[model samples]
Target: MKVHEIRELLNAKLYVGEGLLDKEIIGAYASDLMSDVLASNYLDEKAVLVSGLNNVQLIRTAEMLDLSVIVLVRGKTPHPEVVEMARENGIALMTTTLNMYNSCGILYAQGVKGFSNERAD
Candidate 1:
């Protein structure tokens, strides 16, 4: 799915990177814990990070992971610096009224796969 498509599906408001709307989102990773995101190997694929924690660290994490898009859940508004950081890094930032779980579910149902660290246990 493209960034714009996800925005429409989640009823999100774009806060930055309006030009990045056409970016392809092959997968998704929803977590408030930046550590969990940093440790995931599945992020090698092009994906979007979904979280309710609206902060600069979230943008930093996405930058480190080379993620091009971020969806803030539960209608959380990012701080100005967070938005600036995203803008600086050219990452598409958006907010959705949906909670983290529902946000992930909506993306998943649309065929967006989730990042996983499971080992087939």
Candidate 2:
């Protein structure tokens, strides 16, 4: 799914990467634990992360993994530094009023798959 399609699907607000809304996302990874996300290794440049962590580290982790979009669930908004870092790293940032569970469900129902491939282990 495209970032814009997801934004519309979740009634999300886009905070960054307005020009990159058309970016394609092949899969979704929903997690608040940055360590788990890093270990999953399912996220690539084609994936989107739905997380509740509204911190600068989220941006760093996404940058390290080359993840394209970060969706802040439960209406959690990132700090200014986090947004700035995301913009600098060219990562799209979005926020949804729905909680993590609902957000994941909506995306999954829209045909977005989870990281079912081999784990980093």
* Lowest-sum lDDT 10-residue window in model 2: 112-121
Q: What is the per-residue lDDT of model 2 for residues 27-118, given as tens digits with 9 covering 90 to 100?
A: 89988999999986656888889999999999999999988798999988779999999999998999999999999999999999887566
What does candidate 1's lDDT look like per residue over 3-121, in tens digits?
99999999999999999998787888889999999998668537889998888999899898888899999988889999999999989999999999999999999999886776352
> In model 2, where do residues sit more than 4 Å from their true spots?
118-121
What TM-score would you give candidate 2 relative to the actual structure? 0.94
How high is the lDDT of residue 79 in model 2? Answer: 91
- TM-scores for all candidates: the values are 0.93, 0.94
RMSD of each: 2.0, 2.0
Task: Score each candidate by Cα lDDT.
Answer: 0.90, 0.89
